[model samples]
Target: MGIIQDITNIFKTKPKKEQDKAAVDRREKQDALHKAFSDIQQQRLHGIISTLKELSTNEEIKANLKQTRHYKEFEEKVTDIIETYNRKLDHIDPSIKESQKLTVLPIVEAKLKELDKWCEEPTKTDKTLIWKNIGNVIKHSLKAIKNIGNKGYTDEIEKVRYYMKAVKNAKQNTKEAKEEVRGATKTFNS
Candidate 1:
């Protein structure tokens, strides 16, 4: 009985070489799919960015907003935010092995969506929400840095920290500028 069972098992099992070849083929197919998906995601991100750029320079928005006392400052800040967002996206290394970029992508997409909405409906109260979205991007960035095996000391990590710090400073400067604009408006109105 044992001999017969052994014979049946030998006949049922695939050869080791065939199994290895199949595994390699499967992995190759998976990799190709991943690469194709990544390319699509990259294209979508570019489109969003281009849309944001156009919104930033939107003639109607510009015409409506240009009458404000701090319109120039607002325009500059919007440009700065867009540039900073681009920098943040570009700072991500492409060679990360674990699809960390994909994990970060949705967060970036969400931030861009928020920015798009904010651009469409410009309001002073929404600045906090914009900063919140920016903060989420920065937080996800830090997570990406950590996931890549950096001990929070690499040049990449430092640059992310610097960006975080720069954002803080920008927020502060924005508050001060807004106050000044308010004071100037009050004086002009009086």
Candidate 2:
């Protein structure tokens, strides 16, 4: 029974290599899906831009609009939209300059480095809270990265900011509590 239980446990917990391979596979799948979605969005934006350009160049439409006081405003708005969409397309284009892209691994690694520095200092907060906050930060950061070019990206980034603030607040509260405890102990002694 002991040997059977041990075998079952071993099978239940995946080997490190298998787990690493599964993670790699999952990431690859996610990246591929993201690229596909980005490509589709880029194509749709290009189509919209082309349609707008065609309408803008139409002489009859241009002549009709030229007579209106708002013609200049319409032209300006259309131009602005085109330019903005083009910039967005450039941002999502994988072929763009490397500097323009957000590399997730490096950013996460930098954050981890900061976390290491912060962890070196002991605090009164429980170990679980510190670890939980750290996990939340990483979670939100990844969510932000996953949402790049999407409407939710800003929201995810904001969540990460909130978690960071929470950590800071936790540390501050712990210090204040410690100080209060020390004062009470002194008063008791007196």
Candidate 3:
């Protein structure tokens, strides 16, 4: 029985060439996206990455942000907000990866989930509120940064303001790149 199963498994598995091709395809897609994002945008994406990093631990969550029954709605709302942010980022730099930047809504949801888990603990504190506030600031920062094309940064928290400026810088870089492309495409006929 073992010999027969081994023989079947060998035939079921895909060959190395096919797997290699798939891997190459994935890399090409990733590179294409990365190439579309300019150097400045990439720099901004990497810089200030810490601001978005999770600060709240599971042990910190004293209670759920909402009732268990509302998890679905909470999920949808988080996803919508994240997708909106991603859309704005795509406008600024198509190559930028929100997931890696931890700007993705899913990452935010995961942090919230950790908060929920902490909420399960009998003992509770203000940490839940703090995490929620931080999450809001993060989301607001994304929205405000999206507007940096015209409005620029606000005089809010110093850390968030710095990241907002980075967003503006990225937008400026994208704008300049677009102008350069337009200039290159323009034709002067004799």
Number of the top TM-score candidate = 1
Each prediction's TM-score against the native?
Answer: 0.49, 0.45, 0.26
Looking at model 2, residue 47 earns an lDDT score of 41
The stretch of ten residues in a row with the least summed lDDT in candidate 1 is 144-153
- Report the Cα lDDT for candidate 1: 0.54
**Model 2: colliding residue pairs:** none
How many steric clashes does model 1 contain? Answer: 0
What's model 3's overall lDDT? 0.46
- lDDT by residue for model 1 (1-190), tens: 9999999998998889999999999999999988776665555444434544543575644544454444565566556656755676677776773365455555554554544454434344444433443334344443443334335424434554454444435545567989999999999999
Judging by lDDT against the true structure, name the best candidate: 2
Which 10 successive residues of model 3 have the least lDDT summed? Answer: 54-63
Give stretches of model 3 more than 4 Å off. Answer: 1-37, 54-127, 148-151, 154-190
State each candidate's clash count.
0, 0, 2
RMSD of 1: 13.0
